[model samples]
Target chain A: MSSKSTTKRADALRSIEAIVQAAAECLGRNPDASLSEIARAAGVGRVTLYAHFASRAEVVDAAMSRALDRGNEVLNAVDLTGDPLLALERYIDAGWHLVDQAQALLAAAQRELPAGRIRELHAGPAARVEALVARGRAEGAFRTDLPIAWLINVLQAVMHSATEEIRAGRLNPERAASHITATVLAAFTPPGIPVPEPRGGA
Target chain B: MSSKSTTKRADALRSIEAIVQAAAECLGRNPDASLSEIARAAGVGRVTLYAHFASRAEVVDAAMSRALDRGNEVLNAVDLTGDPLLALERYIDAGWHLVDQAQALLAAAQRELPAGRIRELHAGPAARVEALVARGRAEGAFRTDLPIAWLINVLQAVMHSATEEIRAGRLNPERAASHITATVLAAFTPPGIPVPEPRGGA
Candidate 1:
């Protein structure tokens, strides 16, 4: 609790933050990036990295966890009480931001981690979306016959696909996010219902 | 030609077909499968494989070409003369067969093949899908607000994702093809239009 001890604590925290950020960036650029490369990018020594994380897997797990934490915050912030359709769109719009922020980590996580673990990371957001879909169905905003789980999966797939399109330069990033929101909303609209014009017209 | 010469040519053709099929199977199982392993799977010697394919790249390319040929055959068989919506469903339903048959090779192809080469391979099918989407739009069966190109991309993405879900055991293969067809049809239906229930409910 002394001033010198507090300073040391602050310095340690800063170094850890820098290392984690650099690891995410390095892995984003090259999923197979090495520890030394990450260390160099963080402007830290190997000793420092090893002191905080023991192995490459640990580093990857930490980076993914950090990314998921950021995503969860965005998912948490979407106002669930509003129009269920708008809430779904808001969640998806915010979801894309999280995707952009964790672009590199998301790809790396899929490649490097087990599916079960990846599912665990996504469970929270998936549940939130599931709730939104349930609400949409209740409000007659979404189809009632399709399984709720399938609808949620479609939303996730469309978002992931949009990310791929943007990365592949097939979709412009400016319109990609809004396009995903519109496509998803359209997909969920019930068979008997009329959908509003898709947002962000092509 | 002499009978002996004719027989020899037939045998050579059989060997090439066997080798290509084996290469695809092996690459599907292991993207970095050894040439010797592929030859063994084909019941041929390494020398024979090398004689037919100078390198692994040649083998991979040949396998991909073989898969694409099979896919083109399926695409060709879809009766484009029917109702545009039914034609689209038929194309999607049949497309799943190609996707299943080439699943392993497709994944390996993406990882090992150049993007330009992959794009070239997809060019034919993409054109077919784009034409179908345009037809659907013209028929007033699909939304006109979105670009035909984007709609085609969505169709491709949804199919690819459904394939992944099946691979991951999240979706039953029995229902996956139909589910995909339904999801795609629903996604394409224009605003103010009511699509019949999505094909496979669950």
Candidate 2:
């Protein structure tokens, strides 16, 4: 292939990355952001955007995929190897920022993607929680009376609820991570046991 | 009014009641159940069904309303007085039955109704939970460290997650209420406190 052709390919790839990044920012701020707004945010023209994505749904899907990729990166960095309770607190803290970044984009994705497709994309994060919960239960740090899957489900539910509370302005965003971690730790503590305190205290 | 006309009016009212009842049952069983299936369940002709509901969305809305009405009746009968912990257990038990009956209908409603409309319809139940959580916190039966609204939101989220778990065959239906009560009680207990045991024990 000619060097000129290779340069054109690199430029096209750069354009697509810029478009997806702008889409994630725009949709993350407002789920109803328009395609024109996204194109403008990317510093691209409508013709260029249309050259890539065919519709709003396609753009939203790409943005969602990018957000999930970013989420996986954040989640992968957390050291989940210590005491289950402290590890859970660390995970919740990181997870909160990811949720904060991707929430509005999630709303947009829900509108544009199939429910099963979204669930499929979430499998990675879910598996991480499942593994942690299983380990916690094995170590007797978490309750074993309830099914492992249900425990994981409850944790996810609480985090999502915290996000909603923040969105509605009922929860203080600054303290959301601590509140979530505290609530989840208590919930996971086995019955007849005293709920554990976080490193800095509740 | 003439006797013949009065009887005709009464019969029309009865037919509408039957249609709504059938709609609730059909949609409660299958969110994707067709209008024809609802008509069959109602023992009415498709023309009669169409005469009352202009479209499938209309029928689903009516069905959802009926289901919520039924849910209100069930919730109202629960004695929410005395011993906040026990009251919570009773509420969870009653709420589980309500969720089981209305889960599919809720799916149908989500597809057909505006999100705000559904949230509006849910105001009654949410209010009940909020009132109970407030009472529990004031009595020192529940934690006050977390905001009351966040706590209530977490409870609702856990309950919803339990319903999903049951639907996915991950949670045993018979054990759901106890699991929900136990998990919620632990989460609500103030940090450093030993989680309370349910009446029947966790």
Candidate 3:
């Protein structure tokens, strides 16, 4: 509670945040990158990294947790008060940015982490997506035949694929985010409804 | 040619097919699996493998080429004569089967092979898909607002995602083929048109 202790606490939090960010970046570039490499990238000492993470697995966990936390923040910031369809688009735009930032970590988490944990990490955004899809279906804005779960999976699929295309240099990052937004929104739109043309006519 | 020479030619072709199949299976299990391992799995000796493939890269190329050839056969077999929509669905169903079989090899190929070669391998199927989409668009069964190239990309994306889901065990293989077929067909379907319900309603 004292000023001295509070200052120490703030410094510790900053160091942890920096370490986690560096780990995510390193893992994104090389899934097999070592702990020492991550620490060096973080500009932290071995001792400091050890002080925060007990082992490599702990580092992986912290990095993935931080990335997912940031993704949830992005998803939450998409105002849910707007049109349900627009809300879905905003969520995907923000979601893909997080994906672009932490793709290696996300892919690693899918392979290395427990399914339950991965599901838990995704729960927040998934719930928001489900709600939006349900709203769209109820309002007859989206297809009713497709289950909410499947629709959510399709959205995630598009995001992952778009990210892959960008990383592979098959898609231009400058235009891909909006391209994904348009493509995915159109995919989600129900039959009997027409989506607006791509802005600027191509 | 002598009968003995003809027999030798048939045996050589069989051996080559067996070696390529073995390489694909081993690479699927371990992307870093060695040439010796592939040879052993093929029930052949190191000399035989060396005679067939000059190097690891050659093996990778052969495996990928074999896989894509099999995929083309699947796509070619899809009767394109019926309703365009039905033809598209049948193509997807058969295509995913090949994907399921060669996924590991296909993924390994992406990392191990040249991008130009990979594109070349995909060219046949991509052209077929473009033709199908064009037919649907002409019949007013598919959307025209999206470019044929982009639509083909979406189809590939959906296929990759479905395969990922199946590999992750998040989706059942027995059902995944149809699930993918439905989802992808819907993606290709114009916003204002409704795809028929799955054979059995979900």
Candidate 4:
């Protein structure tokens, strides 16, 4: 209605955006970051932050949702059809950014959110992996000897392990995708079959 | 020393052992188990428990040390010589019990112990895996394409993932060793080589 009221509304929305963005960056850097630290990063007063989020958990919840939303955009664009192995590589490459962000935010989320809630947020990404693995197994591209769930767990574990390797400075970030692709492909290849070569050149 | 004093010291030592053992079981069952609950489980009064452990962290640290000590006993007995693949299978089968125990205690350890301390406690087990992988690579039984650290991380991650799978009721514990061996052997095998068959019937 009134121009003055509209201006106030815009200002409030702008402040919320800034807080969430800064929260993502801050929590990504340090899971133990305090609300005061987040407020400082957002260039807002404690009062302003409190006006929006009721607690640190609320802030973390918002930050996690925002990060996942951004991640879904990247993941949704990857074509998961066609050759199972190739699709898997594309998924890993595209999903790397999300994995990086999620790994960073995971500590904070664990501290602030319920385990079930965190699992709920991850269900979509996980379902995608499960479906792809099932398809690969049916096509004989993946090992059928291990339970499908075990195979899926191994795939996720390898990716997470790669993230950790990068974090520990033992592996180059630039080379992570290729390394992950190589390791996972070999692991998933059916027994009695020669492991596949690394797909993309490191 | 007086005979009375010697008897008192022995009783105190036994009480301490009881407390630590009970703590391991309680924390294993629920990482968030309270000090009072631990005391109850130990069949000791609150006063007696606090007399020995000043705080929850102290109790957790003790429990972790005891668990690791017990785990080392089992892990130490596994002969790590001979065929790397076969050695690995033996290592997995023997280490499964330790993995089950350690996984249960990990949550409590993470909550009470410093990250560095936790890593330090794990360094022994981890180094064993690293050394084995290095040897495997040198012997051409494992791939040299990935970093030694990445390979070690994957092996550990897969084992932990298997533990999670069993916890989720998706995998039978009886089959975990076989599944872990199969997944890991395939992952580590040099590219262009056929993945190894599952060692030991599931």
Q: Best candidate, DockQ-wise? A: 4
| Model 2 error, position B93 (Å) | 1.5
Please give, for residues B1-202, the per-residue lDDT of candidate 4 as tens digits: 9999999999888889989999999999999999989989888888999999999999999999888888777787888888999988888888776887677787899899986687678787777867877898899999998878777777788888787777777888888888888888888899889998775743
Provide the lowest-lDDT 10-residue window in model 1 chain A: A193-202
Candidate 2, residues B131-176, lDDT tens digits: the string is 8889998998889888887887787788878778787778888888
lDDT of 3 by residue, B167-186 (tens): 76677778776666666666
Against the hidden true structure, what lDDT does model 1 obtain?
A: 0.80
Q: Is the docking of candidate 2 incorrect, acceptable, medium or high quality?
A: medium
lDDT tens per residue, model 1, A1-202: 7999999889888888988999888987877889999999999999999988888877888788877887788778778777887788788778887876667677778767776788787888888888888988998888876677678888888888777777788788888777787778777877766666765564
Local error of candidate 4 at A116, Å?
A: 2.8
Task: Give lDDT tens digits, candidate 4, residues A11-119.
Answer: 8898899999999999999999888999999999999999999999999999998888888777888899989999999998888757866777877998899866776
Error of 3 at B9 (Å): 11
Error of 2 at B156 (Å): 1.1
Q: What is the C-alpha lDDT of each candidate?
A: 0.80, 0.85, 0.76, 0.84
lDDT of 3 by residue, A1-202 (tens): 8999999989888888888989988988877788889989988888899998888877888888887777787788788656776777677678778878778887677556765677777787788888888888888877766656667777887777777777667777766666666666666666456654554332
**TM-score of decoy 2:** 0.83
Chain B TM-score for the candidates in order: 0.83, 0.89, 0.82, 0.88
Error of 1 at A59 (Å): 2.1
Q: Comparing candidate 1 with candidate 2, which one achieves the higher TM-score?
A: 1
Name the runs in model 1 displaced over 4 angstroms: A1-17, A29-32, A47-55, A200-202, B1-17, B29-32, B47-57, B199-202
Question: What DockQ, on C-alphas, does every prediction get?
Answer: 0.49, 0.63, 0.27, 0.74
Place model 3 in a CAPRI quality band. acceptable
**Candidate 4 chain A worst ten-residue window by lDDT:** A95-104
Candidate 3 residue-wise lDDT at B92: 81
Cα-based lDDT at residue B125, candidate 4: 74
Quote the TM-score that chain A achieves in each candidate.
0.84, 0.90, 0.79, 0.85
